[model samples]
Target: MKRGDIIELIEDTTFYKKGKKAYFIGRSNFNPNKIEIVWVGEEQAYKDGDIDEFPARLFKQVEHGDR
Candidate 1:
C-alpha cells in the first residue's frame, strides 16, 4: 500500500485484532513485505522505523467514503 492510505486489519493476527483502522505509512525499510502502519486512534502521522509493522497480506486497503 501507498503512504497515507487507510488500511484495515482483515484477518486475526497475534498482534492486532480484526477491524482496526490504521494509516498506511509504507513498507518497512528492512523488509518490503512488512507494511508499516500506525493505529488511527493513536496518531495520523508517523515516521518509519518508529512504529510496529505487519505483513501486507494481513491487511487490505480501506476505501475512503461515507461511513
Candidate 2:
C-alpha cells in the first residue's frame, strides 16, 4: 500500500489485534525493509510513541467495503 493509506494488520498480536486499522507512514528509518505505521482506535497501553514498524507482509490495504 502507498503512504497515507488505511492499512489493516493482518497478523500482528504483539502491538495490535488482527484486523485493526492504522495509517501507513512509509518505510522505517531504522530499517528500510519495514513499514512504519501510526496506530488508530483504542488499546494504547502497548503503543510506543504512537508509532511502530513491521513487515509489509503483515499488513493489507483496507478495501472500501472491508471493515
- Candidate 2, after superposition: displacement of residue 49 in Å? 5.9
Relative to the true structure, candidate 2 reaches a TM of 0.68
Task: Mark the regions of model 2 whose C-alpha exceeds 4 Å error after superposition.
Answer: 42-49, 63-67
Candidate 1 residue pairs in clash (backbone atoms < 3 Å): none
* TM-score result, candidate 1: 0.76
- Give the per-residue lDDT of model 1 (tens digit) for 1-67: 5677888999987766899888877788999889878878766345433577888888888855233
Q: Which ten residues in a row have the lowest lDDT in candidate 2?
A: 41-50
Score every model by TM-score: 0.76, 0.68
lDDT of 2 at 32: 74
State each model's CA lDDT, in order: 0.77, 0.74
Could you tell me which 10 consecutive residues in candidate 1 have the lowest summed lDDT? Answer: 42-51
Mind giving the per-residue lDDT tens digits that candidate 2 earns over 31-52?
8779987766633623545567
